[model samples]
Target chain A: MIAPFKTSYLQDMALTKTPLAKASYAGLLIALAAIPLVTGEFYVGELGGLFIFAIAGVGLMLLTGYTGLVSLGHAAFLGIGAYAHAIMLAQGVPFLVSLPLAGLITAAFGIAIGVPTLRMSGLYLAISTLAFGSIIGTVLQKWDKLTGGFDGFPVRPPTILGMKVQGAIGTYYTSLIVLVLVIWVALNILRAPLGRAMVAIRDSEISAQSMGINLAVTKSIAFGISAGITGLAGGLYAHYVRHLAPDSFDILLSIQLVTIVFIGGLGSMHGAIFGAVFMRLLPQAIAMVRDDLPFGLGRTPGLEPSLFGLILVLVIMFEPGGINGRWVKLKHWCKAFPLHRRAASRRQKSYAKSERLR
Target chain B: MESLVGLLQLVINGAATGCIYGLIALGFVLIYKATEMVNFAQGEIMMLGGFAAYTFVGKFGMNYWVGSGLAILATAAFGYLLDAVVLRRVIGQPQFAVVMLTLGLAFIFRAGAGIAWGYDSVAFVTPFTNSIVKFGSGVVLGADNLSIIFGTLVLCGVLYLFFSRTRLGIAMQASSQNQLAAYYMGIPVRRVFSLIWAISAGVAAVAAILLVPVQMVDVNSGIVGFKAFAAAVLGGFGSIPGALVGGVVVGVVEQLAGFYLPTGFQEVTSNIVLLAVLILRPQGLFGQVIRKRV
Candidate 1:
């Protein structure tokens, strides 16, 4: 293989380095845009759900993947966004206004949780977030007057400017637009110093701090942005679910979001999409084969969770780099087909040490 | 005086349940101390123990004491295999990898138990079941509650003597403190860690056996693992005595909250307490703040 000739730094550092890259990306976008027109409503709706989850997955990827913060309670942010959007829409806010507003509200909640967590990291952060999620869940459940409590809350049909987003197509287009916007923002963040700082913090918090990064402020911002993005996804999700159940945003959903970040490939935006695709497809794949199995395993109530658990364990043990990582490895292998050694550039990372280990 | 007796009964009941939580938390802390890995499936292991006891005693009509003993040994063996086969592989991975691994294992365990025992709750007759003890001045407590307290005390005492007096226990402690140094000193570090896991699981089994008369064993009974997680954190993660104290505090507070607080607050007391502890004092009551150069 030969390297591409680069005339300038601008050419060297361009997001789409080659004409082939640009063309392929454009082709992918075009395909996605035209997809709803050709596909059936069921698929379109499912894809819309995919987009919504992608948005949240990307949001969580920013925090857990890039920033190295594990949040076991991200579903709280999703709920906050959904509930906020529903409440605002119910009170006569326009769709465009309500969505961003919902994002802002959830960001505030994120900061609220994040500010207290300045001194916390890893296990403590995870545990606190778990507790925080349960607290918020209870609030959503018991706060009957506002969230409608156990009876569930209804979301009004969102109208942008003067047009109402009515069905599968509207949700599909809206969510796709949001996903694209989120990806754009996330990419821009990656290019910026902030994203570098986040990566640095993930690699070594002490080193990041020594390098003059404002640990508190940067962590808060990461939390806010991550939550805000998840909230936006939640607003999109409100449309997908129609009637909002408080229990929907739970540890399981939070785990699903983390699964997206893990299975997709940490530190890469494309992982979010790949992860979202897998997340949506697994259940469908199971459903397709549910009736054909020989044993009563087909009728097992907890099959989905166990399958998820199995996938998680397998991925961690064998493919910790996730699907995106595997894709990169495959690409590398193909590019260097004859000369590629198994040990080439396999960076061995150490475990996260507790204080005692340190 | 009557109210005092009522309060004593509540405290006693709370302590009984607290003992269970402590034992489970002890399971968590033991592994955390030994391997720097938190086993999120500790409660699930307990649930397995309960079901195994049910199979032996309830289904096969075996003697309760003997059945429970076998169940403990079985669970301990399972824990050993779990660490040897699954957990040992993730030795150098990120901390979250282990955390997620155990959580996944919890899911698999629950599903496995569901498959083996069915999803319904099961129980067996115990010596302490349905028996009550009367104190002077109209104070009465369930024999199950007394058994749990007495059993926990005896277990703790036994554990203390073993850790201090026995060479294997000392080896386990040394391995937990510094794996490399212990390995250099002729300790089979991996085997010691596995033994610690076995002991942890055995403790969980004891808790499950003690809890059988109080509550039925179901697949979801592993939900207690979350609360026990809270208990372990409250006890400062790695402190043995602190874990017990924290569990008792949480259990007593829970009982008190259920008795006095509004209907909804009862369910969230431990969560709130956990959050409060995490935010205010991350090291917990008995834990030292270990500041690393990293």
Candidate 2:
């Protein structure tokens, strides 16, 4: 790894100061920008969904990874954002205005739940969010007058200056633009004092408090920001899917979001994007190979969930560093290929501390 | 008088369902108190127990009582293996890892059961089935409901005696209080933790067996675990009696709400109660306040 030798503070804090890093990022974006023009409609739609999930994953990673607060109910936030955006559109609000409005509303929800639950331990926070998610889901279903209940809600594409933002290509570009904006915002936030405070609270709450950080305020803000970003994704999601069902936001979806933050890696931004890619592509992979498997495993009703479960269990147990960690190690290995030693870059010895006493 | 009988009957039935929830909560409390790890798969384990009982009694034509006893034993063994093989490795990891791990296991267990016993609801005949006990001239109660209550009481009494009187149970308690100290005191802390899991799984099996005459066992029956979780939190996470009491309270409230309120209220009663309890008194009714040590 190249050691940073910065002459100024701003240079050190810059998101990507190295020319190598800059060139690569610019290249990646250009490739993504080019995908819609060359790829088929099917790929555009699938990639669009990947971008949406990536948005939510980045949001969740901010909370669970940087803030050390795990949320099992993010699907509820996604649903609320989608429904709110759709409802506002139904009232003739412009699409551009409603998207950000939906995000703000979901952020309010995050802060509301965060204020109370953040006072407890992480375990309790997890449980409380689970309940909160289920409660919102039920409310959505039973309040048929607003959410349309079991019948589901239909979403109409937004018109931006007489140009209808519908179809696969439009949604793909919309989500990709939002994803880039989110990543940029997240990068800026991480370099600010609020991000430092969040990381401090995550590392050690007591020490963070001793250092004059308002634990509660910082935590709630982190949750609010995370939820707000997910809500933005949800607003985009409504246009992508064209229909919203209450059942779609159940525990399974919540678990899947957690899987993204977890399997992607806990503390890295690239992990979030990588995880979203993996999650969105897995079903397609399964579908492609459905008829070729030796056993009848492909035709099993619950095979997908079970496989997701197995992967989750295996990942947590064997590779807590996740896909991003592996990428880092591989790069390190390749850099020292001629004189590489496995022992030099092996997984660090983890010290597991008990959460019970502290 | 007839209306009073109806209310009493509802209470009785609610208490029975509550008793089942209590048993499940008790399992959660026992495991949590001992190992400090919450098992999200407790309901799935209970579902497995019911399927086991069905296999023995329904398929093999074994005697009902013997089949149930065997099922409990087998499930308890599975619980022991579950800890030694899978859960033990994740020790010292973050709490969220355990949560996700157990959740994954729950999904696996559900799919496993579905493959073994199809998705359809299934039940076998038990002694309590179709039996009714008359209470004076106005009230009638099903034997299955009575059996559930009776079974819970007997089980609790047995557990109380075992914990207070047995040496192994004392060792289990020692390990739970302080793992390092218990290890220094010649206790096998890991084995005690595994045994605690075994006891918890066994308790879940008993609940499943008692529930058979009242309701059929299916792949979806594991959703009851979520309700039991509410009960555990309501009673205080570490308190044994509190779990059972919290469960019964949630149960009765659910029944009352179903009878008096709109139809949709019943499905969400436990979750609502859970949220309410966490907001109002995070420590729970019988929980001891614990301060984190630096």
Cα lDDT of all candidates, in order? 0.89, 0.90
Candidate 1 Cα outliers beyond 4 Å, as residue runs: A1-19, A345-352, A355-358, B292-294
Regions more than 4 Å wrong, model 2 = A1-12, A345-352, B292-294
As for candidate 2, its clashing pairs are none
Indicate the DockQ of the complex predicted as candidate 2. 0.68
**Per-residue lDDT of model 2, residues A1-358, tens digit only:** 2233589998867898788988999999999999988989999999999999999999999998899888989999999999999999988999889999999999999999888878877888888888889898999999999999999999988987778988989999999999999999998898899998998988888889999999989999999999999999989999889999888999999899999988999888999999999999899889999888776767778878888889889998888878987787777679878877877656556554556664
Tell me each candidate's i-RMS in Å.
2.2, 1.6
Candidate 1 CAPRI level = medium
| Model 2 lDDT tens row, B99-143 | 889999999999889888988999999999999999778689999
Chain A TM-score values for every predicted structure, listed in order: 0.94, 0.95
* TM-score of candidate 1 against the unseen true structure: 0.96
Question: What DockQ results for candidate 1?
Answer: 0.62
